[model samples]
Structures are given as structure tokens and as C-alpha cells.
Target: MTRPAHVLYVAWGFPPARGGGVYRALATSAAFADAGARVTVLTAAREAFERYTAVDAALEAHVHPEVSVRRLPFDWPAREPDRARWSAVRRAAPRVWWRVRKELDRVSFPEVGYGPWRRVLEAGARQVHADRAVDLVVATANPYVDLVAADVLHRDHGVPYVVDYRDAWQLDVFTGRRKHRRGSRVDRLEGRLMRDAREVWFVNEPIRAWHAEQHPAAAALMHVVANGYDPQFAPAPRLEAPDPARPLRFGYIGTMSRQVPLEAFRAGWAAAAARSAEVASATAHLWGHSSHYAVEHPGSSSIPVTPGTPGTPSALPTGGSGGGVVVHGPVSKTAVAEVYAQLDVLLLILGTGRYVTSGKVYEYLASALPVVSVHDPGNAATQVLVDYPLWFPARDLSAEAVATALVSAAAAARTADRATRQACADFALASSREAQLGQRVSALLDAAR
Candidate 1:
């Protein structure tokens, strides 16, 4: 009898670490385990998630029972807020201390906040391999230090590794610019990693093309594995037509980062309300974290938004003529379906960039609700929604354009029949998380044989 292929999955942000990339990591590991692979995940300790970012304890329950998780201690002195834990140098000459710390971190790896983690990750990967021979290594990156573990295993044991880049290491997706100069340390390191990788995965085609241009030798190995909605977590499409008498609900989910055009959305919402009675009566709901960090600080700008009761509006200022806007703070992953069920339309307000394709796009598509796109037309996300039946894309990021899209979406919400809603849901079926990961898992399993 043949045993299952053993796969080592290395990631820095596993569940309980509630970052945008966590869903992909969770789904990827789960996909492998579901495919009958013996999956072992290497990640940071639970304390690290609690200290650095927000935690979604509910998400841990979704992990496949067959998969095993190994945690490592992570050090992130830069984000430490407790002055009591600070060294004297950090308290006195903080800038100088940080400079020295960054230099020390780069001595092991090129990344600043994550470089020092390389040694620990390597040791952990080695120990895991020592216990049972690893058939393949799949490393997802952002701290990119996780890739070092896969590289270590490949070099030491002749194991093949896959680099799953949730985001680019050299290209800034927000600006579509090179983060590192040509022939710089990051450039050299990334080139080496990609060249040696058996397969390379990216979230979108634009990002994959950018990386391919940078590494022509490994172009054929690169693949675009777009982010998709998880069927287990996403709510079923609301086939019932919205009541004409009641006010419509427009919602936005995911992290509200500094780059998100919140001001534009406010202005647009107000304008839409003024122009259309349907929109004027509609309530806009914003869900998810105010920023990447759970706590607001000097370097971070967590919006001064108050959490509203699940079904009620908050007392906070709505910032525009429309009085129905509510900020509902972060929602747990387990409760996402409930949140979607309450809304009539989705607001896809994203930062401007040609390469930016948010994971929210897939979820919005899955909701089968009228979607108003309040982002740059040039954004890669536009391409994803171009063929979507219910998409109402703004021509530009201007307030007028956003208002126009919002008004159209509102009208759709009121008049859209069940067939139209079902068609929208059907369009999104191809983009489910299981569909996106299945082909890759099958290919990897075949190679393992």
C-alpha cells in the first residue's frame, strides 16, 4: 500500500493571524489536505498574531483535521508598543536603535522586519523534514522569509519547492513600480529563488506578467492563481428580489487601509443620494478593520470609526449629506455570511493601481448582488468585473463617476429579477476557492508521484 505524499506548507500569516492573505493560506493548506496529502504547516506562534495584527480565533476551526501545524517564536521589535519591553536605547535614541536593528536584521536576509526569521524558519523546516521525508515544499510569502525555509529544504535534501507569492517581493502592487533597484540584493535574491522554484504562483495575471518580465528564464513556470471566494464561508446568492418599499443596503467588506478612497466614497454616496430617491433611502455599511494593525499608533492611521451593532447604525459622523452610512468595524470570518445576507449591494472601493486585485472582488462576485466599482478603471480588478452581469463600474475615481455607478447599482438592486441575480452567481462559480486550487493541487500530486 502506498502512503500519501508529504507536503510542507510554510506561511507567516496562518489563521488566527487575520491578515488579507490568511484566507489564501488557509484555503491552500486545506486544499492540500483534502487532496489526501500529509500536510504540515509552519507558521508563527499565536502570540505573534495577538501582538502584531488582529486575530480571528474562529478561522482556526476551519483547518482540516488531517493537517498538522508547527509554530515558531517571532520577534518584531519595531512594532512593540509596550514601552516597558523596550530597551534603553529604544526609549532614548529610537531612530538610531531602529537603524541598527534594521542593519542587523539584513545581515541574515535582505528584508528588515522579517529577515531575522530566516534562521528560525530554516531550523524548523529541517526538523520537520527530519521526522518524515518531505515530498514537496510550498512556501507563501509577504515576509518572503518563509521562502528561505523552502530553499533550505530544497538545497539540503534535493526537494522541489513552489513559491506562492500572494504579493510581489520586487514590485509594489499599489504603485506598479519596482521596489528594489536593478541588480540590488532583493532583485538578485528573487531571481535566484524564482529560477530554482519548480512552480511560481501569483494572485493575478498582471503581477505574474510583471514577475515573468523580470525573470524570463522562469517565465513558463509562473502561473496566475486568482483569489476566489470560499464556498464553505461565503453566503448563498439571495435569489429573492429586494422589496421596493424598504431602503436598500450597500456594503463594503475587507480592511479599510489608508489607500482606500474613503473620502471619495463618502462624497459619491452623498451625491448619489441627492440624485436618486432610491439611493437617498439606502444605507451604506462598512465592515472590516480600520487598518492593517488592530491598534492605532503614530505610523498607522486606524480610522476613528465606531463599531455599529450588527443590525443598527452607530452614532458616529457619516461625513456627507447622506445620513445612513455606518461603520460596522471588523467582522469575524465565521460571521461573514451573516453580514452578506443583510446587504443588497456591494461597494468595491479600492486604491488606484493597475496591478491591484483585491480578494474582496471574488467575495463580492459570489454575493450575486449589485456591485458599484469606485476605483480606478486601470485597476486589474476592473478586468475581473468587466464581464460580470451586475457590475456597475465607475469611469474614473472622481466623485461624479462614483455617484453615477452607485445610482446605477441602487437601481439594479430594486429592479433586478431572480434570473439576473442567479446569472451573476453563475458567473462567479468558476472563481470559487476550490475551483482555483484544485488544478494546482492535482498537478502537484501528479508530480509527487
Candidate 2:
């Protein structure tokens, strides 16, 4: 306890970037600060946040000002001007430019758009460590390039590092499929870097098990630290639900990514509404940016949707989603709870099953409201919500199955038992992001020597 381990935290989506990773990273950097460590966060520029994902000024308000945030320029090709200098392929046509860039991006790193930012990140990590010597470097991977940065810092500076795999880097978690080619160059690199990591953190048991099975020895160092709710985003005084005359208001909060089965969501929604006279009495609400809503974009094999404005939902059968599924757009973290107050039920939807334990789940559970699982049963969110007295879990993609679950969850919503409410509250008590990660970093620091 005499000396706290200085963690040079590297994350791409720190606060102000409303990407889900921001919550975990913000909570993490702040969590380290709470543990009495001097935390210097090296991240990409705020402008980058606005471009890659929706900008969350409200999220910026909750960031721990005590933590020193140093953001490097993250200017990428996508955000670049001077197409005049673009290679012939990129300069040819808008369509060709996208393909050319996609190819180049994959050549740079497995992730799109972000793969090329690796050099800046590595330099930032090393530069932060140089100006202020750090005992340990804890890098959270999403672009997964942070691992490369941490590896560089450790290799060059001997700063012991921890690689927090909020989600697995090699596994196609959604499909329960693996991406790594055995003994492939990427595989060897991942294995080598993780080999010397001081610690590794995962968000849930399934992901932990997958990583453990893949890197059995690393399991000793691996820890499963679930994504906890951010206290700042926790629901406040319950807002009255829309009038009973208004349709049942179910809501989803987070990115409208293509990976998400938006069509499936539409199907389930239509099925539920058509079957239940109650649905005629209710509407669905979606909060967040749908730029990546797979269905909204073409070329994606996911269900296709005609894309247009941001506020409207995809076109649905009989009743268009724009009318039935009202998108409120991205809310400030401060206003999140107010939005939750408007919902009779929360929709838990994500790109990947099980491996996905949405940071919002904690906040959702904390709302003490009924949640409808629009996700896989294997998800960590389910693990957290399963114990909650009021959750109705949807186990499959079947519209009938989802409709039934929604009905059940809706019924539970009307007369949510007091015990259920309290249990929801108690369930989230320790799940506060700051509290959870504070405990985690404290222990990691205690054993660091």
C-alpha cells in the first residue's frame, strides 16, 4: 500500500466517445485514480470520438477530472482530407475508395479504420511512460491495438502490463467461432504479447473460459471482472411511464450496429405486436446512433433496412418502425436515467452473445425495471439479469418465442414486486463502475510488487 502502481492506461474510446468501450475505460481510469494511483490516460482525440462514434458531451461531464487525460491526434484516412493525395485507387470513385481503404485497413490491422492508428498509439504509450515512469501499464483492447502499444511499452521500457480483453480478440464471439489461424502470424503475435502480461481481465465467465481454454496458462493471471454500471448513469427518481393509453414503451440503448440483428428485432417486434393486442397499445423506443446498424447498411448480410434520417426506426411490416419504434437519439449520460424512466421495459440487444456483457446492463438493472432479453441466453447480461426477479429472457431468434417473452416481461412490468425492485437495486449496489473497478485495481496494485 505504501506505493501505488502507476497505470499508464491506453484506450481508444475514453469518455466523450459514447462507444460502449468508453464506459469501461472511463470507469477504469477513474477507478485507478480512486485507488490512489496517479493515472495518466493516453487516448485518441475528442474530434475522433465524434467521427468514429457519436460524441457524448454528457459522458465528458462524468469523467474524473483528477485523472490526467492526454489525447494524441488520431487522424485516420477516413477522417483525412487531401483526397488529392489519395492513391489512384482511393481517388478513382467513392465506391472504389471504400474498397481500397477497406483493403488497406485490413492490411494494417484486423479491424477496419482503426488498424492504421497503431503507430500513434504505440508512440503515445511510450511517450507517456517516458515523461513519467510507470510501474504497470494496463491496456484495454477494442481496436485491440492497445495490446500492441502495451507490448511496445513493456518491451522497450520494462513496464509490466495488464491486457484487459473486455472481449476476446481472436474469437468471433457472436458466432462462437474462432478467427485465429493456427500458428498464423497474427496468432503468434497475440500469443507472444499476452505471454508476458502481468494480468488479463475479461468481462464474463464464458469469455474467461474461452480465453482460458485458448491460453490455459494465462488463466492463472486472468480475472473475470464484469462490466458494472456507472453511478453517474444510474437511474434517478423514477419518471412516470407514458400514459396507459400510450403503447407499451420498450427501449434499447446503445449503438445501432450492423452486427446486431436489427431485422430479427423488427420481426420479433412485429410478431409480438401482431399477436398481442397489448402491443397495439405500446411502442418501442431506441436511443443511440445507428450509423453502424448492419441492417441499415447494404452489403451486410444482416436484414436490410432503408436508411435515411437518424431519428426514425427501420421500416417494418404494417406499422413502419419510424412510427412504432421511436428513436430518441443519443442522450447525454446525465439524461440517461430520464430516458429509462420513459421505458416500461428495456431491450437487451447486442452484436455478440455471452461474450457481450454490455456496460449498460448494470445501469439497466439499476433502473429497477423489467428487461426484455433480445440477446442470446449465453450472454453475461443474462447471467446478471437472470437473478433479477423481473427479467424475461428470450433464448432464441424465433419471433413467437420473443413475443411470448415480451408479453411475460410486460406482465411482470405492470406489477413488479417490491422485492424484485429491491433485489434489482441490491444487485447493482456493488456493480457501480467506480466501485467495481476500484476494488479490482486496488487488489492488482497490492499484488503488483
Compute each candidate's TM-score over C-alphas.
0.96, 0.86
Off by over 4 Å in 2: 1-4, 78-87, 93-112, 237-247, 292-323
Which ten residues in a row are the worst by lDDT in model 2? 311-320
Give the per-residue lDDT digits (tens) of candidate 1, residues 224-333: 89889988888788878777767788888877788898878888887888999988877887877767764755534233333465422232223322267777657887
How accurate locally, in lDDT, is each candidate?
Answer: 0.87, 0.73
Work out how many backbone clashes candidate 2 has.
8
Q: Which stretches of candidate 1 lie over 4 Å from their true place?
A: 298-307, 310-322
The TM-score between candidate 1 and the true structure equals 0.96
Residue-level lDDT tens digits of model 2 in 267-340: 88778878777765667766776663212333433444433234333321222354366544555666777667
Q: Give lDDT: candidate 1, residue 426.
A: 97
Please provide the root mean square deviation of candidate 2 (C-alpha atoms, Å).
4.3
The per-prediction tally of clashing pairs is 0, 8
Residue 439's C-alpha lDDT in candidate 1? Answer: 96
Instruction: Give residue 258's lDDT in candidate 2 (0 to 100).
Output: 74
